[model samples]
Target: MTQDPSRADMEAVAEQVFVALADPSRRSILAALASGGPATATDLANRLPITRQAIAKHLTLLTDAGLVTPEHGERRRVRFRLHSAPMQVAQQFLAAMARDWDSRLDALKDHLER
Candidate 1:
């Protein structure tokens, strides 16, 4: 069954999502996850310049951020998949920020024109 997220939960989720995306390495990880269905730390490390250990750390952060989840597959291999809900929240937050900036800019323009 699905559970609806509360306001505080959404705020927490959004904070974590933004924090995860703030790092370039994490963003790269997310990109990789988006391109590929799921990948192990070793697989991601092989694709990127970072070491497997570093990749694992990034994966941990992403997992804690609720942007990704690990699934067991093929023995001890742990694969991660993107969780798009928080991403959608991040996108909406960004869009809202953009809109607010636009409004402020429009007001500034009007003030300058007067």
Candidate 2:
């Protein structure tokens, strides 16, 4: 397989994902869309305590991070839905980090035992 990019780029992508997930309200918004399928900001507003305006702001961030996609609807209504691509990339990055740490620990253990 191809080697992963430099740490700087990986960190940037991870940072974006982390920032998108940092807000509790955004997480709720993601969960709502994930569970309820694609929906408008108004639809999400009804299901969540936050106002539609707030949800719209959160959606903008999500879209920027590639976590959510917006579908243009009739009458200027836009539907937002969870996009798994960014999350999948983030998950893979975390798993790779875990594996690297595990290998480093194993090497340390070998050195101490020597």
Residue-pair clashes per candidate? 0, 0
lDDT of candidate 2 over 1-114, digit per residue (tens): 555566556656777888999999999999998899999999999999999899989999999998889999999999987898778777777987899999999999999999
| Model 1 spans > 4 angstroms off | 1-5, 95-114
Residue 88's lDDT in candidate 1: 86
Q: Please give, for residues 76-98, the per-residue lDDT of candidate 1 as tens digits.
A: 89999998988887777667668
lDDT, model 2, position 90: 79
Residue pairs clashing, model 1 = none
* Lowest lDDT 10-residue stretch of candidate 1: 1-10
**TM-scores, all models, native as reference:** 0.75, 0.89
lDDT (CA) for every model shown? Answer: 0.87, 0.88
